[model samples]
Target: MQEGVIVKALSGFYYVEDGQTIRMCRARGVFKKKGIIPLVGDKVTYTPIGTREGVIEEILARRVELVRPPIANVDQVLLVFSVKEPELNLWLLDRILVHTERARLPGVILFTKSDLLENGDECQLWVSAYEKLGYPVLMVSSRTGEGIEDVRSLVNGKISVVAGQSGVGKSSLLNQLSPELRLKSAEVSHKHGRGRHTTRHVELLRLASRTYVADSPGFSQLEFGDMEPEELAACFREIFELGQQCLYRGCLHETEEGCAVRPAAQEGRMAPWRYQNYLEFLSELKDMKERRF
Candidate 1:
């Protein structure tokens, strides 16, 4: 048996890369019987049956796992957001950031379509805000080929997953970095300003010698599954830290007396939009808890 990583899995066949070559393999019967299906990014042992073909013998442990794209052992998430066409969705971005934080993955925000940002101040403001939070933010335009080097440097030598809403130019950016991708790109609707979904499944692509990029379908609605109301605050690092300073021990940080989070937002110490999303997520958890009973 040879050790390799499952770079791609499609239609019940896994393409395991053993450094020298890729072997098309199927999971051993033991995996199905044990209910442990292999996923892309999983390190496994497989026995070669023929040229470019093998049988997966065992799946090794994973460092991280994501549900939406169903990838494992991801190093970081590249949160792509467009500055103009689809317009920025701060709420959705915050939600995704929180989810990445919960998964213990570092997130880098990529603002695409820099060429469309004629009013540079607006773009600067958005970049500054995220930068203040200590997150690495990049502004890139595939058409202009700006900031592609910086993005390439970040993704090089790591397995990074790119995610964002439809029309954010995730695939275009990928193509810009590695022209070999030749991935499909859709134009934004003049009426809705949203681009159509072009990527159908999640697959890992080798952009460079040691760099891997996972391209997945755009997300329209983001759901942070199974996070409790109390646990939700932890996902929002900024708010969670302020909540710790609240006078009340068990403060929900919403309309409560001596709520530190509210006061911080009112004082402009924290973004009000982020606080509002926290309440929305908390409300969803509360509703779920009530329904369970």
Candidate 2:
């Protein structure tokens, strides 16, 4: 048996790479009987059937699982956003951060198209805001090759998922990182102020011997799946740290008397935008919970 990782899934066939070469494989019948659907980034064991084919016999346990793009065992997420185009969507960025936190996966924030920003203050403001929340923020311009080395160093020897909304230069960044990929990218529509869907599937591309990165399709909407309204605060690193100082044991931090978070926001201790987005997410989750019951 050979141990390998599934790099791609297409037409019910899995492409498993075992360092030396990639082999086309099909999962055994036992997996279907057990209601298991193998996904890209899955560590698995398979038996070689012939020169180019194999049968996956066992699937290793996953460390992280994402339902939106259906990937497993992800080590980290690279959240990409453009500094100017379509404008920086802090709310959406926070929502994605919440998703990573719930999945217990670390995330890095990458601001693409930095070359387009006229002044340094624009990038500095965003960098300072998210870095305060304990996330590493990198300013990268695929056109200028700025911070590309930093990005390459971060994803080396790990399973990383690159995600962001349309028109954020996600595909352009990928192509810059790995020129051989030649991933199709589209121009942002000036009229709509958004990018068209260029990446249509989720597939893991081998970067180095042990480094792999999965390119996920760009999306605009994110739902707080299976997340409780009360648990929302814990997802925000800054809010979670400050909640300990609140007078109430279960403070929602929304107009609640003696709420440390609110005061911190008012005093500029925390970014007000992040605080407001937190409230919005909390309310949305509450409504989702009510609809479920």
Candidate 3:
């Protein structure tokens, strides 16, 4: 048996890369009996059948798992957003970031299409704001190769997943990093102002030894699954850190008296947009909870 990582799973087939090459494989039937579905990024051992094929013998332990798009053992979330084409949607960005926080995964913000921005003021402001919130933020133009190396350094030896609005250059970024990928890309619809879905499935593409990246389907709609309304605060890094300043216990930061978060947002201490997005999300969660009953 040889040890390898499952890089792609499609139509009951898994592509496991053992560093030398990616071997097409199928999981043991026992896994299906036990309800053990394999996912990309899962480390496993398999028995080689011939020169380039094998059967997955076992799936090793997973470090972390993501519900939406269903990938496992992800080390980081690459939040790719385009600045121009479809325009930057801060609401969607914050929405996804909140989910990342909920999963306790480090979210890296990569703003694509830097070439469209005539100036860096907006990106710099966003960078300064989000970076202060403990998320590493970067601006890159795949067309110009600006800040591509910085991105390369970030995902050098890690299993990072690329996510963002469609046509935001998720595939383009990966293509730039590893041109060998030649991943298909589409243009953002001029009429609808959103890119058509190019990536239909999740597959991990290897960039270097021990380094892989998964360009999953882009997501514009994400729901907070099974998370309580009160759990939203801890997901926002700024809220989690500044929440310690709340005067009262069990404070939801919405209606609590002497709550530090509202005042901090009111006083420009914390980014107002972050707090506002939190309120919006909290409202959505509350609405969902009410609908449940």
Candidate 4:
């Protein structure tokens, strides 16, 4: 049996790369019987049928799994945002970070289109805010090639899910990294100030040994998905740290007496936007929980 990673899923076929060549393969009937769906980025073992075909025999256990785009064994989430042309959406970026934390994965944020940025202080402020939470943030421009090598270094030995809203230079950055990819990219619309959906499916593209990125479709909406209200604080780094200091055992940090988190937010110890986003997410989770009853 040959061991490989599933690079793409189309129709019902899987294309696996075994460090040499890609082979089109189909999963075994038993997998469907077991309610198993092989996704892109899965490390699997398969049996060859002929020169260019094979049958997937077994799927290895995954390190991580995502539901929206449906990928597996991802080491990190690469959050991409643009400085202009459908400008930076910190709200959306924070939302994605919460989901990333919920998935128990590390995330790095990249501000794309650095060339269009006229005010570096605003970018630095954002960078400082997120960096304080232990996330690596970079300002990158595909046109100017600034921070391109840094991005390459960050993802050199990891499997990252490239995600963001459309027209944020997600695909363009990859193209600049390696022109051979030639991934389709669309420009932001002048009318709506949003980008057209350029990526339609999930596929893992190899960059280096053990370095693969799952280029999935751009999306603007993501649900917390089975996450509990009380468990939300743990998804935000600073809030999780401050929860230990709360006098109440189950403090939600909203109007609770002796809540260290609220005071910190009020004192500007944490970025105001982050605390606001946390409250928004917390409220969302509570609403969802209430509706379940």
Clashes within 3 Å, all models in order: 0, 0, 0, 0
TM-score of 3: 0.96
Structure candidate 4, residue pairs in collision: none
Global fold similarity of model 4 (TM-score): 0.95
Q: Write the per-residue lDDT of candidate 2 for residues 1-293, one digit (tens) a residue.
A: 99999999999999999997889999999899999999899999999988788999999998778887788888999999988787888888999999888888899999999888884445787799888778999999999999999999999899998888888998888888889889888889989888987777888888778888887873346777788888999999999999999989899999988899999998999998999999998899989999999
- Locate the minimum summed-lDDT window of 10 residues in model 3: 118-127
List lDDT for all candidates, in order. 0.86, 0.89, 0.88, 0.89
How much does each candidate deviate from the true structure in C-alpha RMSD?
A: 1.6, 1.5, 1.4, 1.5
- The collision pairs in model 1 are none
Give the winner by lDDT: 1 or 2. 2
Q: What does candidate 3 score in Cα RMSD to the true structure?
A: 1.4
| Tens-digit lDDT string for candidate 1 (1-293) | 89988889889999998777888999988889889989998989999997889999988988888877789889999999998789988888888888888888999999998888875346787687778877999999998999999999999888998889888899899999999889999988879888788787778888887678988773446665677788888888788889888989888898988888998988889877788888888898899888877
Task: Give candidate 4 misplaced runs (Cα > 4 Å).
Answer: none
lDDT of 4 by residue, 146-257 (tens): 9999999999978899888889998999988778889988878999898888887788888878788877773456888788989889888999998899999999999999
Instruction: In angstroms, give how far residue 142 of model 3 lies from its true place.
Output: 0.6
Residue 250 deviation, candidate 4, in Å? 1.2
